[model samples]
Target: MRSVIDIVDLTAAEIDGLIATAEDIIANPAKYSEKCRGKKLATLFFEPSTRTRLSFEAAMYELGGNVLGFASADSSSATKGETVPDTVRVVGCYADIIAMRHPKEGAPLAASMYSPVPIINAGDGGHSHPTQTLADLLTIKREKGRLSDLTVGFCGDLKFGRTVHSLVKALLRYEGIKLVFISPDELRVPDYIRDELESAGADWLETASLEQAMPELDILYMTRVQKERFFNEADYIRLKDSYILTADKMALGKSDMCVLHPLPRVNEIPMEIDEDSRACYFKQVKNGKYMRMALILKLLEVE
Candidate 1:
């Protein structure tokens, strides 16, 4: 079975195909209302979630599929020391597919090895969030009219932003894409990610100033500094407010430039900026459901 444990699990062609499918769904919603009429989706979330979990359940419902599973580890058999493989094995029998989020990195990958049905990594600690990247790709395609030949600025918490990492990996496959990393020195993009970008001959640059990079970017991707990912509370306090995107700061960006955020924004983005035409984050949230619906249909091999 085909599973999406990482964004790379799906090829550039497959990603493009999924984007096309999602676009079609957006245009013709009623036609796909019963695409997955008899399928079941199991959402096994070991960590706290609002957007990801709800989006998965909503996507399945939109496709006429049923959803079952837990919202947290304490409510699941994992509280009784149930292993990922065992939990996946059991869920695989009852559901046609599984979307799992865990606190440990690579947990979904481990579960995918033993699952009979397809496994989608909802989020795995600081590791990967492939589905979020899909939503991002679709949003970019819809907003910018194309994905390639664009300057994308990623601001805040680059070190722990799985969505940023996954999106960067997916963007590497496209041509004429330039990545600008904007973060505090302590939260800069990981060296491994830099190494991969360097190895692939991708165009990218690092900056501490979001304003300096703003005008050059076609897409401003904002990310919150995750307090949950920090070991030192003092460090989190020092860096948490390092990059807040305000209207004055956003004025430096191009008029046509789009701003994207994987949501549940704490204070990284001011609420006033939500009124700006450039703010595409809410649209990104809606695109998530479409992309996920397209993913469910593709994974289940439904026509």
Candidate 2:
């Protein structure tokens, strides 16, 4: 009867359960392989996000379930006059569960109203990406050995980074967590987020420089500076390479500090940086699959 619309929808205990399940899948992968056999995951992507779409499909496939759906809205009847609720109602008949990514802010929320099957919001506009938040939590737990009491620095285009926003909200659910925000003046963390942090009493600070925050971070989550989110391509071009992470940047941090990204990079992080042992983004991506496997088992088994 519940849908994962945002990170806030998950209680602290439930989030802990998910993280524990993710780690369990990592340790015992074979046990989770046939958990969702005969089920079907329908991916309804209104936008062109190959990574997110593929991740969802792969998650279902790895769970011994089949995947069926469209990669973009154009290829589906959505391009015509079909409403989100209507589409969900129709797709729910054929799909055991639905994962939808839309460009509209409340599209997934709208669909969940009539969906017979459980609905998951993949990335509704710049609003939320809860599963990616799951990946972030798992990465921090695996890399740092704990989530609470560790400082996390979120660098790059924070103003429009949905992953950062969702992760911040989820992190607030834990105790003794602190955040350091790094972004250019124009792309700084928005006031609404600052208000939420203050209201929740989550300790945080903002800075334009990454080096100042780097040394203190237990985990550094880097996000891409999206050009489409900017008013002008020129401003994005100007700031795109400003926060580039290389060996020298890693040299400024603690040796155990882990680096993460919700990827598809555009020079924000250099290729040479991947050679560093602490560069955990690749492993983070793999962890994403295990996390998804755990989640598929959890959500489906809950009822």
Candidate 3:
């Protein structure tokens, strides 16, 4: 009955364990080559995606498991008005496990409630993305050597970035974690997060300028501001380049600073900055596969 619906459901120790497992897999890939042999993972993605879909397929395939199911909702029975639970019930008959991504908030939770097979929430509507949080944790652990007592900055559209919200909640569990949010007023982190940080006693501050936060950040997490997240295109245009991470600006960051992006970045980060040694988004992505391998193994073991 165990399901991954939120980052908070996993404790700090469990998160660390997943990170360790990812590292272990990276070190010894052959040991896990046939870990999930003959198993099937059903990916029920309601929205279209290249990265998440590919990553999940890669993780399952590398573990000797077969991947089946729809890449987009239009191709699935869901387009015929199939309910989330109904879809899960049908897929459960075929899949040893299910990983779902949906546009509706709590859709995966609804799937988990009725699914006979284990369910993993791939992503949900502005809600939570726990697996991405796992990738972020693995990245943080790999680059910085630890998670707690560090300054982390979040830049760009915080209000709608599910990854940002999930990561903030995940970081709240650690001791002495401080957060710096840099964004225009309209795109700043929401009040719920502000309240969560305050209640958790985690030190946090807001800044309109990325420069002010760069010097203090041990980790800088960047996210894009979508035009849809705003009411008008003008606002998106005006602030689109406001948070751009350039080589010149990166010089202000701490010597050990690691830059991270959830990927599919659009102009928020300069291409030149990609060459920087501290840019860990690509490595972050590679770790995602390993972390997901550990997660697939663990969730399948939970019963």
**TM-scores, one per candidate:** 0.99, 0.96, 0.95
- What is the clash count of model 3? 0
Q: Write the per-residue lDDT of candidate 2 for residues 19-125, one digit (tens) a residue.
A: 89878777887777788888998999988886778888888887789999998889999879899999999999998889899988778889989899888889987
Return the clash pairs for model 3, or none.
Answer: none
lDDT of 3: 0.87
Prediction 2 TM-score vs. true:
0.96
Q: Pick the candidate with the highest TM-score.
A: 1
For every candidate structure, what is the RMSD over all alpha carbons to the true structure, in angstroms?
Answer: 0.7, 1.4, 1.7
Error of 3 at 295 (Å): 0.4
Candidate 1 per-residue lDDT over residues 129-149, each given as its tens digit = 999999999999999899899
For candidate 3, give the lDDT of residue 254. 90
- lDDT, each prediction: 0.95, 0.86, 0.87
